[model samples]
Target chain A: MSNDNIIYPSVHSFSNLSLSDSSRTGFGYNPYKGPSSNAITPETSNILINKKTVSLTPTSFDSIYDRNILKKVPEISLSSFSFLFCEIVNWTRNNSKGIQDLEQRLNTLGYQIGQRFLELVKTRERIKYSKREIKILEILQFIHGAFWKSIFGKTANELEKSQDIENEYMIIDDIPLVSKFISVPKDYGNLSCSAFTAGIIEGALDSACFPATVTAHSVPKEGLPLRTVFLIKFDESLYTRENLRFN
Target chain B: MTLHSFYIFDRHCRCVYSREYTQGSDGGSTNRSNESDTAKLMFGMLYSLKNIASKLGDKEARNNLKSLSTGKFRLHLFETATGLRFVIVSDPAIDNLQSVLWELYSNYYVRNVAQNALSPVDFACDELLANPKFVSETDRFLSSLPVFR
Candidate 1:
């Protein structure tokens, strides 16, 4: 796993490899005559396939907006998604020894997703790059509204601070999409399937350098049944820093 | 044509919610016990049927069994990815109950029950049933259906 951190060569890096005369195949194609700068020129973009190299012009590719991101968001069938989630929960349950272990496993899975998703969302919104979230509240609001909307198709219902606790915060989702179809059996005690969502939030926060613990808690209401509250507790050091920097 | 009842079950085959719309008054405490027992039996049967259906085909390809008819009533089943099951019992000849189920799942279940932050893991089924807005909206939708008239 440690070796996985080593950066591998990109296709663009192949240009440097062919620069050396000894490594070159001497196939009449002059590797040195092209623009020597790092910018992607027509000559440098040529990719090698087998023994043959195909030169691709910049026009061969479509615009990034047209090819990569869609104008309209894609929709997923909710029923199909629910069944798949059910199986995931069941599979995790079978492999885990207890409810806590099962939750930890789910959290681990969601954590990886959260890390990747944060980067993707950040890059997609690069045009709006003004400042990184330095203030604690600013980042929490970003996660509560923008991040939640991007993933779940809606903003979280509520964001509030605990009346008594200084560092404690809460983000409430009227209905958590991940646990939409989940029904924990009575034997599981107080297991909230939204624990997976909590993990995702924790992962994103940790990646953003705000280190916190997030947990999902069920808070049943009169009409809304599957409502969940995600409790976020920041590290003591974060509070100390926030006071020193802001106050 | 009359809509009889609706049942909601979790993955564990426990009946989380049950409602009767058109049953005649058999006024007694025994009716409550009987209704509970019937709910248990109904869930057990559905569980077995799901198992049998999966065994009949490739396990991965076997989606939830959608509906079944017993000549007198038709049971329409909707299963979510997380294994929550919604079962509606109605007249045997009713058409477009699938749409009704979809409306119930999306408009009612997702909006009222699932979205309520105060809803517990058990789903606060009784609270959902008692909510006036939920009840009225559902009643309006059902009455608007041509079959209900």
Candidate 2:
């Protein structure tokens, strides 16, 4: 068995079955449907018999709404957060094998947070006509706009499609929020703390079914020394699939 | 209020960045010689002054020496928690440049020197910062300010 799809029995009503139905066999009952369409298979009497062993906690089945989900994000001290992030970088640096490995570790740390943040952002954003972003351009725009603002309090500086490559794009940010206070040592060659932010973009895209690889590069401008370019490379199969469906 | 020069000293009291706008600024754009010697003397003077200024105040509190002034020019000092010092030399008539130095630290130095992986955290003796991007950026930022001549 592949174990691809395992459907568990719905525990709706244990007290509804009578004591006479002990001779049941292939057991399946969905209470939502009418009695006319019910399978009425002779199920094992074990589930029907009220053993009174399992007690459903008040938080378990019925009350599924998360009260904190809709709550607004509270203000946090910037200095405290900066210090915390600085400590994390310092700690990670102590154990990392090399510059690239250190960046990779930082990116991995931010990946899960980005995945969850995307879902939460999407939930809170679209109140009325909520829809999943399937189109590539639409989702990228959404990320560049509301998603960026929600996290950094500002939208990305620039979003550009690569002229040379078919499935490459770039998002530029002047002074990424995470590495705002970070100063890399001279020995750590070309290691940007914004790798974490790149991972966030990657995680968000992957979770949204875009499936892209993302990396951050420090590309300083005349005045914008902290300017970083997040290069996103979409998987080849996505382009093929999009071409088939949308084109 | 003419901005004459800017200096950055690492925690070890070594001058890492020095930019003199008016050629020589010891007597309001009027003296030039050994650059490294001048930087050392400046750093030594500031180090002692900082110690004296902080000693006169409540000992427990981290009291920072804000500025020192003379008839010709003034030196405004801003030190980060990490012990990196930023000192700017300008006309004595100028007002408190604490906020200006803070802007330099946050918006300029931290962004360029700190964030640049290729930039060395530790400077070699007598070695000055040579990043063109950082140099141009600091110049661009200062030139736009009203005090910069």
Best by TM-score: 2
Task: Look at candidate 2 and tell me the lDDT of residue A95.
Answer: 79
Q: What would the per-residue lDDT of candidate 1 be over residues A196-217, giving only the tens digit for each residue?
A: 8988988888777677888889
What are the per-residue Cα lDDT tens digits for candidate 2 across B1-149?
A: 39888888888777777777753443232112225687789889989988897888898998888899999999999999999999888899898999999999998776676655445567777666766567777777887888775
User: Is model 2 an incorrect, acceptable, medium or high docking prediction?
Assistant: incorrect
Model 2 residue B10 CA deviation (Å) reads: 6.2
DockQ of each: 0.06, 0.17
Error of 2 at B73 (Å): 8.5
Off by over 4 Å in 2: A1-67, A77-83, A86-94, A126-129, A157-164, A172-192, A218-228, A239-247, B1-149
The estimated TM-scores of all candidates read 0.53, 0.57
lDDT of model 1 at residue B61?
88
